[model samples]
Target: MTALPQYERLEAPAIWREGPLAQRREVIVVFGDATLMIADGRSARALTHWSLPAMVRRNPGKRPAIYAPSEEEGEEVEIDDPVMIGAIEKVHAVLEARRPHPGRLRGWLGGGAAAAALALAVFWLPGALIAQAARVAPEAKRVEIGQQVLGELTKLTGQPCASRAGTRALTALAERIAGPSAIAVLPEGLKGARLLPGKLVVIGRETVEGPDTPEVAAGEIIAASLGAAQEDPLLRLLRYEGARAAFWLLTTGDLPETALAGYGEEVLANPAPPPADEPLLAAFAAAGVSSTPYAFARDPSGESVLGLIEADPFKGQPAPRPVLEDAQWVALQGICSD
Candidate 1:
């Protein structure tokens, strides 16, 4: 979902509790298109992003409204500001209204339990079952899981860098270089690029802020996309969580927080190796982006990445098109400024 225009600039103070036993700390809340962004009040480092649709209000018509991320009970946030509470309620109302009402479609879906059971019965060996789970997971569920993992990453990375104009530029850059994928630039934590589920890639702010030309950032994103193309990130998550996690997802349609715990740390600890040279060069050649910047970024002395530098596509000529427009690049540079 995209950022909601009406509440793009709206932010307020609220009490955030990470879990049932965690201490309640004051946090700054911002409304995104379909999520509630909670950030540290002092540092402004993002703490967690809550899905509004999955959220449930614990206190209705109460002065200080409390909300939780799931029906089974999980992290909670309390808001006293009337405007913030109203904005949150408004989005929740719309999402609830948009639910498929009890009709022919809903009835048909409800009656399809046999098909679901059939699917679950098609499992294989432990390794194959995990692969099958990831293979059949729907896009929406994949995106939801991706966002959850991203929030977990906040514990170590701090908030992702974003500004209205800067985010717009980021979206354009992602579409330009990586098809319909989403890319995030974090203020800190990541040193390079890390692929997340749901076609999301999180890169260090340096890739965007340190480069004079967008070509460098373009190269980083291109390389990350190449890694994702080679391996399904969802499979990585399932394999990390073990076979039981995949089985739960196949039977219950969602993984519990317990099942997903520590996944962010796992990803940060073990990043995927760069894609092979042949495919990397081919991708660079096809996108009309130069591979020299990427090679240089990896090894400034040009010792290790000599192959990329030597076989660099478009070495003698300019790219087919600029990676990003001048204005877009300028905005991207200041993404973390706010």
Candidate 2:
């Protein structure tokens, strides 16, 4: 196989324009990588990315190279630093002289043929891989993983909710937003809501009970589900785990028992996923919910929500469904407390 560049520990000197109003002054140069990033500190936040070989060819070894913008021109600075310029020149020479391995050339050809075959299979079989994945990912395994995660979450929270009431309320809200056909399943570490292979909607309680109202919770659930509709949930899982994981899932029908434990803690600590316009709009219209609260909750500045606000799906009309009844609302909030 042709050896790709080893990028493990190499660090390159980055350049930046020092003074205010300097043009194309800042440059961030990484020595050994597929691509290079260049930032101009002179102008207001000017950044550019270029292929490594392309950048090397453009700057040749003579002096410090300044990349001037097409629209405006700026005076170039002379870089006489022997050490810094020498390093860059050496890397450029090495890149030019390096040749692809013969074995790697054959492997690349084989990989291309394999990729073409895989594409043909996917096109003709449509979801054959995903279906295969689901069978190997048994419902029993999912339920087991879900229960384990629930156990950890309860421990983290110091106790289970006063009752299953919080879960019931969440489920109710999910039903309202997803319509009666949707099912809400709670699992431990799914940082955000997930649409499972069996048309199941998986969510984490933190997102539901986090600052947003039931409407916001419902919006996220529907958004996740819509994304799943476009692609299989199992495929997403495979993507996260890689082709080996996909193969394992297909062969065994279940992800490893400890598969999601580590991620659970991270999900609890991070910011929740935002409800984007397309899915949010679709879910909002379907559930008769307003996008206002969800949008603001995601972006307090109101700038990120321009899309939602401008194309308000619930424009000038009453929202279709109440996310949760009064009793359910109280129950959901008191979930951990109880």
Candidate 3:
């Protein structure tokens, strides 16, 4: 027996034609587990169900995407809704992936069609593969990659400062912001902070020493985390190495050492773009930290990041809770002294 198709249910408005000469009618398209259900927009009644596996895109790259139940069918549906189009494309891709491979003779006969498919796959496959790799990668592998990247980074920025007391304090701060996340204070080179795989956050010594309060350092950590959430570090690494490298890592669970050699330098030379104010403020609020100090630190005159200041999560409150005690802050400041 065949297994049931698993997919999310989605619905959107669509213009559908029953035949080549038939007039178009506005209908509601509902994407189901294994089929596309067309419903009467007014009566909310089912009109037809198109099997997802048999559906095909009639136009390759045209706006107002169109689809048909089969190539020989005269009926077609034109959907302008991006969400519905994306859902259809996703389901089509999944179905295609599960289809059986063509025979050797068929492959030779369809060489031209195969070439077109290969071209499209080349453009679309790598990102999807990289995303899948990042999602399924084991924690041990993530840690291994993080450690390797950190090691390469040390060559450019020198070893991360290490004092027993400072290390303890940094760990405390990291725990407060993100449980089980680790922070490393480098001697120099990093602008603010950069997150690595395995929940490792790297920071410049200045972030701790330049500010009087731990809130500044905490804010930077929050910012780095927010950036990482937007773009996964592993995905960036895979993209930099290209599809071949990504495929190799996907199959073997290891990245080529050469691919990561200059990554640290690249990160240090190019500062990460600041996260959006809404998300950044949300991050600060979630951590019970203030963004005012970080805003001032970014621009002493407070002209550029005025939004962060005006919308400070802890603004109206009486001096939000301290990130660390006086002694802990002092220890964290001296992290590079060793």
Q: Clashes per prediction?
A: 0, 12, 0
| lDDT (Cα, tens digit) per residue for candidate 3, span 60-94 | 77869999999896999988866467556765654
Off by over 4 Å in 3: 1-124
Residue 188 lDDT (model 2):
39
Error of 1 at 217 (Å): 1.5
User: What TM-score, to 2 decimals, does candidate 2 have?
Assistant: 0.49
Better of 2 and 3 by TM-score: 3
Candidate 2 or 3, higher lDDT?
Answer: 3
lDDT tens digits, residues 1-338, model 1? 32434312346789999888999998998766667889999999999888867888898988789988888776888888664675566555445444566754765655464444333234423466678889999988888888888888887889888899999999989878864378888888787788788888888888888877888888887887788677888998987775556767887889866877788788888888988889999999988899998899899999989889899888888888988899999999999996
Error of 3 at 151 (Å): 0.6
Stretches of candidate 2 exceeding 4 Å from the true structure: 1-164, 179-212, 256-276
Predicted candidate 2 versus true structure: per-residue lDDT over 97-170, tens digit per residue = 35354666767766655664454333212234444554467656655544544454544444433458777886
As for model 1, its CA RMSD to the true structure in angstroms is 15.8
Leading candidate by lDDT: 1
Highest-TM-score candidate: 3
TM-score of candidate 3 on Cα atoms, chains taken together: 0.64
Ten-residue region with minimum lDDT total, candidate 1? 1-10
Query: In order, what lDDT does every prediction score?
Result: 0.79, 0.51, 0.78
Q: Which residue pairs clash in candidate 3? A: none
